[model samples]
Target chain A: MSTPVQAPEAGQATAPRRLGRGTLRFLLPPKVIAGFAVVGPMEGKGPMAGYMDTTLEDTYYGERCWERTESKMLKEAVQQAIARAGLSEQDVDVALTTDLLNQCVGSSFAMRSVQVPHVGIFCACAGFASGLALAASLVDGGFARAAVVGASSHHDAAERQYRFPTELGIQRPPTAQWTVTGAGAVVVTGGDAAGPMQITHATLGQVRDMGLKDPYDMGSAMVPAAAETLVRHLQETGRRVEDYDWVLTGDLGRVGSRILIDWLKERHGIDIDGRHSDCGAMMYDASEQDVHAGGSGLGASACVVSGYLFKAMGRGLVNRVLLIGTGSLHSPTTHFQGESIPVVAHAVCLERPGTR
Target chain B: MSTPVQAPEAGQATAPRRLGRGTLRFLLPPKVIAGFAVVGPMEGKGPMAGYMDTTLEDTYYGERCWERTESKMLKEAVQQAIARAGLSEQDVDVALTTDLLNQCVGSSFAMRSVQVPHVGIFCACAGFASGLALAASLVDGGFARAAVVGASSHHDAAERQYRFPTELGIQRPPTAQWTVTGAGAVVVTGGDAAGPMQITHATLGQVRDMGLKDPYDMGSAMVPAAAETLVRHLQETGRRVEDYDWVLTGDLGRVGSRILIDWLKERHGIDIDGRHSDCGAMMYDASEQDVHAGGSGLGASACVVSGYLFKAMGRGLVNRVLLIGTGSLHSPTTHFQGESIPVVAHAVCLERPGTR
Candidate 1:
């Protein structure tokens, strides 16, 4: 405790929790006490089906629009999280969330009825990790006692916005990623560990672009950005690949995850083979599900981390874990306008307190 | 100082800075050292054109795409801000930014090469104030030594993404506000006041929906949310209209600002008539410029406050100020699907630190 994670400067008493270039050491780590996931029919039938708190047979979820439906999915997940934690909506101090929709209306509309003070964030697919990192920071900084973080994406909605309308039944390439239809929410509280996992540190990523302009090749675009954050996190924390039992990415999907692993080995000489997994790749059986590349979206990582990873920790299947939420920042309009894709990835270390 | 703004409940020495039901009181206010604004061709001809840091004769700003132009506009603004603050990029510990584009590509891509650790936020037009509030909080919480907050909007890009392609020359309603093509950036730091103004307090608004679903009528949608935060800030801080020299709304425009004033008077019995003005209304001559409702977008408020008001304060022409940033939350898809528009507003108190 005396030495602390960050060393004090010549004039400072408590060192600013700056880890390396972009990583942050949360001296006061926040506990992840509760989480919930809701998925659409397609996602409900995926590999992580058993992990979902609820699966909808109706994609609309009784809403007229896919955007509103996505909002409902997020709202229900957060509400379920608070209820599962044995608290009322009033007890959650803040809500950090965003969706795939423009202006993040899904989150704002959801929060309208939920009524918690909101901090809206947008990071494409990386929203889950981004939101969690911010909420944890707020909690550690004593800004909030309890923070509810949520993210969501609906396939039909994303398809229309990013590409052609679903009614067109547009042919997709093998490199295309199917946006997952679902929502995930997690409750983070600043206090003694009251749950199976706690967020100990976070590395905020830099926007990275390697001239990958093809919107269909997003996995390739995000892979290096993911590597950047992971490497920065390990170097900053002075940890190795062996430090974490599992190194999970929100949604690097199948092709990207493999490329990322090989790239990490070649570039940084860090080989994370058996320990690595991607929420995108693990969420679905690509061939069986007809999801060409793999799953990808804000909901993909949110569902995997909040539902699968949290439950796994609770069940003692996994203890120490590193969750890297990756996002590919591009739009069809921008793509048409000849812009290269920019990607970002955020990494947070999670652990079962006693095990760590 | 002993009798802190937030009265402790029972067993606390310093209150946690929670005021009334929703507002936050900063025990250590953060200083606003420098701010810069860059605007496009149309905006360069506006009323406050003389106040901008940089203005472009070409709306494209030499970029092939509007999104990239907007990003460049934001980058230049931040660079100008750091220069004006007598600091370098290395002095900025963190960058907070957002834009109207999907995934906030304008900001993410702009930040890709800026090399600053980033926090990507999305609250539509309210991004300037929202980003600054969070940056101030990070500085006050010791997460950042100095934080740079940036936001931007491009008229052509927004039109295509939100409605139609600019080539279509879409017919517009009188209620529709023109999207100001511009960017703004502010440098916030902890420690002594670097200039005339400091952020003293902030009230994060809850999402409010009044069932108005038209995308063009954003100003009307956001008016109530703006009023709510203003009233809450006043009641929580136990301050009256006389407490601040001016209370400004981000981009409520003409119609919305008038509605807000009347609503505050009728609903809360608080009349702030002569002392109030909106950045939207002040940005352009509505009738003469053919900007029907008035100027709007992330650039509207950002350009007015950071470029115009910040300079005014430094010149000792103004003292106390309250900036209420308003955002309308709705998508064209959601609107067509019959969902109501949701809105949010954030209020931050600014003042001359020593005088206060």
Candidate 2:
């Protein structure tokens, strides 16, 4: 299903060039050799079902509990990604992973048996995007020959931790997005590899708080950060909306997606109306899925990119792609303390090997 | 008290060469220009009190809650570290931060006002070591000329989340370590910078589970991981224990340190008795402080390195040091689920630029 990228000889060195204002231009771009996604039954019935590598018969995935299930799904995604890339555990040097679970136990436990050097990262749902930037940096800098990045989230596991328990069957407001029960992994290698997808540029994001405190309304809280990063990436990279075939966001959902378009147009004088599509908004059939706002969780972006987007890219459906992963950086503790939510977004530019 | 490191011209590119196994040898190493530690009043009376930049009279640090106080301390540490380096926040390209808090609110909320690009990392207490490696990779690879890495933890905040509430005055087992109420930050720059401390190499650690499930006995659970990383680092770098002035382990505390010494001797046929110390074990005067096993939090390593160790390094007390940050990756939920503790350790080799 995927062609493996060639790795540089052991002890090789690569360089990364810092570009205008917070942007990094990898001199030897990192190649995305393979991606795999494992999702729950509901997600398998969604729009991108065909692209899913594995759809569990039950949420437990045969595990004893939801947390264990989430961990198992992440591990499966990673192993499948490596296998799909024609690589093995030994070929992978590092694994950068995270999930919405407290202390990032989902990724930690998942990577426990993978035997790859692991680094846990957390930026709420934006973890996958941050993981990509770091993994690409490692590969591009020759710190690692191949790096695997993954993120996972189980709806039940996340609900009990962030909100009320699923057993309570508490009502969710219209502003609340449904946490996706899925996991995704991607294999990134050095520029020497022969892969269709290449990460050429990245932009690091700053935390931006707009004084929004409603935990249910995370989309609104995260919109400013998304806009900030997208604008920064475009300006720093000297690119325009027309320069890319698509501008994909992580999981801003319906309300946040609308806010993003209007915010970009009003604040940055840039319009992405036609170019923009959100992973969250596209995850499910809005009318049929019964997801209030849209699909969320780190898994939302993870599953969408690893399953739908990468497959589309392989088929030449989209070439130059700018993916911005946005996150709401607030804990229930902070929300209870009446503090405003802080948010962040990271942008990575992936392109077809020979494309503009 | 410190000198600012010189940064290369914008767009400069540097290379990082891969070493044996899991180590990365930086062609141009990153220099630690400055470090700052902030602690609560209880920590102020500890052995390293003199080294602390600020010791708050109260745990809240004038904040309304323990969580906010932790965030404030992290931000203050970052600001003070940059200032001590004779740089401003604008000069820092990135901030890699994490804490014991769920979702890493301590670092994220702290970075909210700093305006620097933020990357949240979590490896329990090993986050600072991971952050240092990533920060060094960015600087060495020229992705960022200047990056600041910080970790923070508040004892009260952590107790309520990881265990029982402080108000309960729960009796801790003798093997359990006291969480540190502190924060630390360090500014890292490209090798062009003339600084006293240089990070020459780094070794990423893999997760290791030894099937030890007792949350109170984290030291025993983490020992195997510490030994694993330490051995890998030595074998990869071709360095013996005698090569380093000190082999520091992050927050192994008393029990874990003892276990590490024995584990290394038995498993790896290496001994680190005379050259070893633990940040957790050394954080307080055990007899006087009544801190059970010892100080154990992300802040334990952060405070020690930024305060005691760095000061000692500056004074030529230690030249070449290999600091291994250790973490036991287990949450209350994992414990409740009957899972063994998974642990990880990351090592960074720091040296006085001219030293052997």
* Best prediction by DockQ: 2
Instruction: Give the per-residue lDDT digits (tens) of candidate 2, residues B6-71.
Output: 443232244337875458887777899999999988889888899888999988888888999999
Q: After superposition, how far is residue A268 of candidate 2 from its true place, in Å?
A: 1.7
Which pairs clash (backbone N, Cα, C closer than 3 Å) in model 1?
A: none
Candidate 2, what DockQ? 0.69
lDDT (C-alpha) at residue A73 in model 1: 93
Off by over 4 Å in 1: A1-15, B1-15, B20-22, B165-171
Alpha-carbon local distance difference test for all models = 0.82, 0.87
- Candidate 2 lDDT, tens digit per residue, A1-356? 12223443232244437875468888877999999999999998899899998999998988989999999999999999999999989899999999998888999899887979999999988889989999898888788999999999999998989999999999989989989999999999988887778898889899889899988889988999999898888888778877787888988999899999999998889989988888887778898998888988999889988887778878877777888999988988888888899999999988777665
lDDT of 1 by residue, B61-103 (tens): 8987788899999989878888898988878877889888877
lDDT of 1 at B336: 73
CA shift of B264, model 2, Å: 1.3
Categorize the docking of model 1.
Answer: medium
- Candidate 1's iRMSD: 1.9
